[model samples]
Target: MSRVEARPIAEILAEVANAVPDEVIGVEFERARRRGAEVWVYQLKIIAKDGRLLKVEVDAATDRLLVAEED
Candidate 1:
């Protein structure tokens, strides 16, 4: 069987920095269903400078931002 390797963490963090520009509080790797297929994701918990908590998800394979919202 073949496997999809996730992108490097440094690259993922850089991508997140560009998208969020906030202090990341936590990070986790998760397997989720997207378009009915399983995909790997990086779930980030962040704190905005304005004091709002945020949640962000990035696709591990493509370095794409899947979701970002204030929590």
Candidate 2:
């Protein structure tokens, strides 16, 4: 099997930090399958300056924002 190349975590985190106006408190790596293709994603837990918890997911291979929700 061939390995897929993913973007650097620092780069991804930098982008996320720029886009979101919150502080990233935690991060999780997740593997999922989509349309028969294996995909890698980064799940982030963020704490808003005002104390709200947020969850964000970004595609590792494409650097695409998959999900962002408040919890």
Candidate 3:
């Protein structure tokens, strides 16, 4: 089996979703190459009750969730 990266993408997304007060609509893993490493980028779409979409990107290796511009 391949060695898992710094952290699991599912765990990272779960943590971020739990931290958010809004409701999560969708979660997807994006394949991208970063810093010579094949990194998994998690795109989380949160649907607010007020009808707003919140998108965030979480790094699979670092589990760092970064809030992006609202959509």
Candidate 4:
């Protein structure tokens, strides 16, 4: 297993949430875990300052991130 550089999880979460269509007023990294050997799973909740909320899943590994659909 290669050593993955530890990044500020908050930064990663922000990047993922920012990549979404509209800007989210607030974002949270609800949860995260290692998947097998090469994947890190993250569950995020994005909230628009106005109150719109969305949940998304992000998988990160080897300096890469994959965001999954909510539904």
Candidate 5:
């Protein structure tokens, strides 16, 4: 069993949904990842109306954006 307890995916999704930009047209859950005992990474697939797509990683514990590349 893992020593660190992670926040629920629904809760994380809610938080992430709030953090996402309003212009985003849609969102898809990519995957949930863990780095040893350090952090939980939540990857989201974001889509825009202009046909733009992005993959973002957010920290589950703190609800912080760990990575999001814009182009």
Candidate 6:
């Protein structure tokens, strides 16, 4: 099924890149089942400047950050 997004995936990636200023290695689009509705989310895998790997998810509709994890 196709996912719905407020903006283009590139724009979402750009927003993430702007916040981290790191190398984005991988990106994935996810459809989350929420209250019987499918919500679009963008996952950004980044290589931090400090050499740590990070994962960030953003809400496609609101452009709000959902999660940010580093390893």
- Candidate 5 pairs with clashing backbones: none
TM-score of 4: 0.44
Give one digit per residue, the lDDT tens place, for model 6 in 4-45: 566787888777767779999988888876557778887888
For model 5, residues 1-71, the per-residue Cα lDDT tens digits are 65544566678777766776535434444445455445556666777556677767777667678788654
For candidate 2, lDDT tens digit of each residue in 1-71?
97655788898999997899789989888897766877899999999998999999898988899888997
lDDT of 6 at 16: 74
The candidate that achieves the highest TM-score relative to the unseen native structure: 1
Q: What is each predicted model's overall lDDT from 0 to 1?
A: 0.87, 0.87, 0.74, 0.53, 0.63, 0.80
The CA lDDT at 53 in model 3 is 90
lDDT of 1 by residue, 1-71 (tens): 87665887789998888877889999899898888988999998999999999998888999888888887
TM-score of each: 0.87, 0.83, 0.67, 0.44, 0.59, 0.77
Model 6 Cα RMSD, 1 decimal: 3.8
Error of 1 at 18 (Å): 2.0
- Superposition error at 24 for model 2 (Å): 0.5
lDDT of 3 by residue, 1-71 (tens): 78656476567766876777778788788777767867778787888778889888777677776546588
TM-score of 2: 0.83
| Rank ordering of all candidates by TM-score, starting from the highest | 1, 2, 6, 3, 5, 4
User: Could you tell me the TM-score of candidate 1?
Assistant: 0.87
Clashing residue pairs for model 2: none
Give candidate 3's error at residue 69 in angstroms: 2.0
After superposing candidate 1 on the true structure, give the runs of residues whose Cα lies further than 4 Å from its correct spot. Answer: 1-3
lDDT of 2 at 38: 77
For candidate 2, the lDDT comes to 0.87
**Regions of model 4 farther than 4 Å from truth:** 21-38, 62-71
Q: In angstroms, what RMSD does candidate 3 have relative to the true structure?
A: 3.1
lDDT of 4 by residue, 1-71 (tens): 77654456666665765576544444344335455444455555666455666666555333255554432
As a TM-score, model 5 comes out at 0.59
Output the better candidate (1/6) by TM-score: 1
